[model samples]
Target: MSLPLPLIFDYEEIAGKFYPVIPIELKVNEKRFLTRAYVDSGATFSIFNAEIADYLGLDYRKGDKIYPAGIGGHICAYIKDIFISIHNIEICCEVLFSDEFTVKFNLLGRAGIFDRFRVCFDDSEKKLYLYEKAYSDFR
Candidate 1:
């Protein structure tokens, strides 16, 4: 089933812009949060705040530590496995938990869940379309 991506407005700009944001449920062990996440195609991996790890009983300092770069710069983080649910579809994937508070919200990225679906963004209407893809179709 195809789903719509709810958009959030960024009032920081002159007129501000809307970003495609969707409701997602993140699960780790017994901890879970139903939060909003931005869909970012440029990002290589899903990124979340370290607070989530801490809330989920993870050290947030362990795991495979590495540096990931963004438009602002690079930051150090640890990779961990997490389960995310969107549009009633759930999947387990690798996610980066950054200790720095620079990341204000969770980002849904290509490597994690974005690659699993066909996505389309329509700025005129501020709408996003997502469709789960068949493995054979990608092959």
Candidate 2:
């Protein structure tokens, strides 16, 4: 079975806060899990909460330490490889693992996943397309 392409929603800023939440289904260790992740173009890598990794039975010890920061400050995180799929497209890449105190869901960043796909934001349709290649070749 194939998964549908990602649905992109227009990010709106409330007060001075920017909310860029995107719905995503993550496949790890042959297990499927669904959650909403914040799409952050500014981030260099994708990150997932430790609780999610534990629930999915992902091996935490295989990960390496990486430092990431939020509004509060910088924190040490673990980075590991996982299989990510969207719209029948699957790719193996490294993702960051953070303790529950940091975040709840995954954070889709610029490297790994996003770098592999040609992404287009259709403001008119309010959808995000992850093209196998470029937008012109997308079906």
Candidate 3:
């Protein structure tokens, strides 16, 4: 069965331009941090700013280090397992935290989120639909 939730795209003003963004919660142990993220289909992994790791009291340096090149060039990131909550659906997955990821928005990429959910983006109507592939993480 599909998850009944369909998220509306949130418009955020960045440098006088509006962009569609989504709200997501980052979880580590019992700590949760709510933040806005960009749904980036081109990204290979979910990546966030390292400040979030500090907020979660994580020693982010302890995570697996990696260098990923993107349109903006290469960046250093650390991979850590954490629960990412979008609305009520939560999934435990690997996410990268980077001090070098200077973009204003964190990225919800293909690896963890896309692999677990069937995602549809409607730009004309500004809507995002996410359907769960499994019930394991539905709350």
lDDT of 1 by residue, 49-115 (tens): 8877888887767789989987788989888888898866777888889877476657888875766
> Which candidate number maximizes TM-score?
3
How much lDDT does each candidate structure score?
Answer: 0.76, 0.69, 0.83
Candidate 3: residue 40 Cα off by (Å): 0.5
Candidate 3, superposed: residue stretches over 4 Å from native: 1-5, 10-18, 136-139
Encode model 3's per-residue lDDT on 90-131: one tens digit a residue. 888788999998987888988878877778876656567777
Question: Which of the predicted structures, 2 or 3, would earn the higher TM-score when compared with the native?
Answer: 3
Sliding window of 10 residues with minimal summed lDDT for model 3: 1-10
For all predicted structures, in order, the TM-scores are 0.82, 0.71, 0.86
Our model 1 lands, by Cα RMSD against the true structure, at 4.2
Report the error of model 2 at residue 50, Å: 0.3
Position 116, candidate 1: lDDT:
67
- Model 2 local distance difference test score: 0.69
Write model 2 residue lDDT over 52-85, tens digit each, in one string: 8888888775788767877778877888887776
What are the clashing pairs of model 3?
none
